[model samples]
Target: MRIELQNTFVELRGEQNPVASAVLDALRSNGATVGAVAPVPDILIVSLPLLPVAGYDPATQLQSAMATGEAMFARGSGRVLFLVSAAAGMPMRRHAEFSVAMAGVLATVRTMAMQLGPKVLVNALGVGAIGEKVVAGDAAMLGHASVKRPGTVAEVADTALFFCDPLNSYTTGQMLSVDGGWSAGYGRNF
Candidate 1:
């Protein structure tokens, strides 16, 4: 059962969303040979939903996404790139709902990775604050990001490429934070 899970939901508050566009371009440029299931391409990209810090829901969404990934893993074939965000690690100003939600999703990924074995590598792409118009209003919160500058679409795409590369066989069940250096600093102001 070869599955190509495409995430079409765009976040209302996201600064930039080149992921889907880049993915489409990748498919077009790479041609139709990209979706092979038998040998299964070296990578499988799973774009999960993005929730805001306020009114959005994360629990149900995360659970559903995790279940989808788990089911894919059960089929057994290629590597899975779980696209999460640095927002998952953001400070909870109003509520800790997002944190709790991502925790559950991360847990599911880890557990599934352990049970699946080496053939199926599960990893996550943690996006840092990117300069997008949607997040312009929240500059204060994003100021703490290590680079202090927003990330580019190319940077994110590059990281995704690295994870999906056949040469990256040794890494698995890991959460790669591409958030400049925000995740490292302690008192903020990196």
Candidate 2:
């Protein structure tokens, strides 16, 4: 099936972050045709980073990604997989801010998926403590993840592939956390 891969916040032409690059490469090498600005396709994979920068805004970034995905869906794209990585499940520096921002994005995606009908599916991959130094530091502050070891690139890539595949028809508006059981242990009442 054809795919439209959107790399939001891509500054360097043809250069991308490791995870994004890996996902694109894996999809292409596995025989999926990749298009940038397209006649649209069967899927759109959005890989955007979550961080606080002076002029770079996460909300706008998310909106742009969502808009592009919506446009693709309007043009007959089947699914959109939003791949977002936050430092230890925190979208921003503050927990509450992160929660609000994440919720907004999720709600928008879910609503769009519903409005667009069964042809369009929206999914998110929430990664936690994936060996990045910033994530590692955050994980330490939150105590160790239940898995202890950081997740690998292969692991994340595999999950992305699963969502991108046709076999994943039943899942949508879902946040599949590759967070190593981190979300479960948070604020556990002992």
Candidate 3:
């Protein structure tokens, strides 16, 4: 699925992330107008990283997504895309906290979609091993994934575009896995 984002105004929540950078680049390359937060954006993309950081609060990501999503105006015309961890579906035994947190995000996506149906679309991208080689527990990300490789930022960007695209009107309150099939009955369920 390819989409033309011409003249679309997009806002990104986690611009510091590599995946966000890739999404930004892709949006620009596809002719979407991307920059700092717009009071009301055509598309709002939130990239939530799975990295475990010291002193990091778990509620921050969820709260940020909710708060930012709430500001979106333009009823009947808006898309919210969240790039979260695949562990939300297939739990990572070692990363219990991450798993639990992302599960909430997925639930929020579903709930919000229901609450804002036919007006705004709310969805999430379940990311896995996207250049996070430093994650010791996920050292063999490629091996763990059914595709036997870590997912690329470009792939994630492409999927993000799909979710943010106007054509994706029917797919809301869903989480699409962009982790080389890790979350799709492939990894950790054997």
Candidate 4:
């Protein structure tokens, strides 16, 4: 099966980033052809870059997401996996604008899922504070998470595989938070 990963950090960091490395590894392990062109790709992974939308105009933020989504949709068919930051749903003081913009992008994914339907299964994977180790500062922000720890690239990749799996049909218009239950509620281990 041919797969296309759009806006992947692999193009920039070339697996230097742990997440990119994990994603590539997962695809390769599944015995799927990566970066190959086909009439209709089996999977399309849309990784959202951390754009500097803070203090920027709202129109620009919307346009950036819309353009990216449109381009990805135009490229292939089958399944679509939108990878975004969990800040989209979190009340992050430092990343307020970014959170809002990402939320908008998530909404777009939902709309696309509805529009594309049984043809193209579009979904999203919201990543939380990912790090090699969970620092106190990082945990503080994500204290509400049941896991109470930063996520790992491997965890994110595993979830992506589930959503992008060709055999796994019937899942769409869903935003799965690989965020250790942070988006769920305050799970402070008091």
**Top candidate by TM-score:** 3
Q: Pull out the clashing pairs in model 1.
A: 15-132, 146-182
Question: Listing every candidate in turn, what is its Cα RMSD in Å to the true structure after a full C-alpha superposition?
Answer: 6.6, 5.5, 2.9, 5.7
lDDT of 4 by residue, 6-70 (tens): 42322111113455556668876666556644434456566664322365334454454444445
Highest lDDT among the candidates is held by which one?
3
The CA lDDT at 56 in model 2 is 29
TM-score for each of the candidates: 0.69, 0.73, 0.85, 0.72
Candidate 4: give the clashing pairs: none
Q: In model 1, how large is the Cα lDDT of residue 75?
A: 64
lDDT of 2 by residue, 89-167 (tens): 4443444445455556566667767766576778877766565544322444235368777676666777877777766
**Relative to the true structure, how large is the alpha-carbon lDDT of every model?**
0.53, 0.58, 0.72, 0.61
lDDT of the structure predicted as candidate 2: 0.58
Give the residue spans of candidate 2 off by over 4 A: 1-15, 35-37, 50-56, 86-95, 132-137, 188-190
- Candidate 4, which segments miss by more than 4 Å at Cα? 1-17, 50-77, 133-140, 187-190
Candidate 4 weakest lDDT stretch, 10 residues: 7-16
Candidate 3 clashes between residue pairs 3 or more apart in a chain or in different chains: none
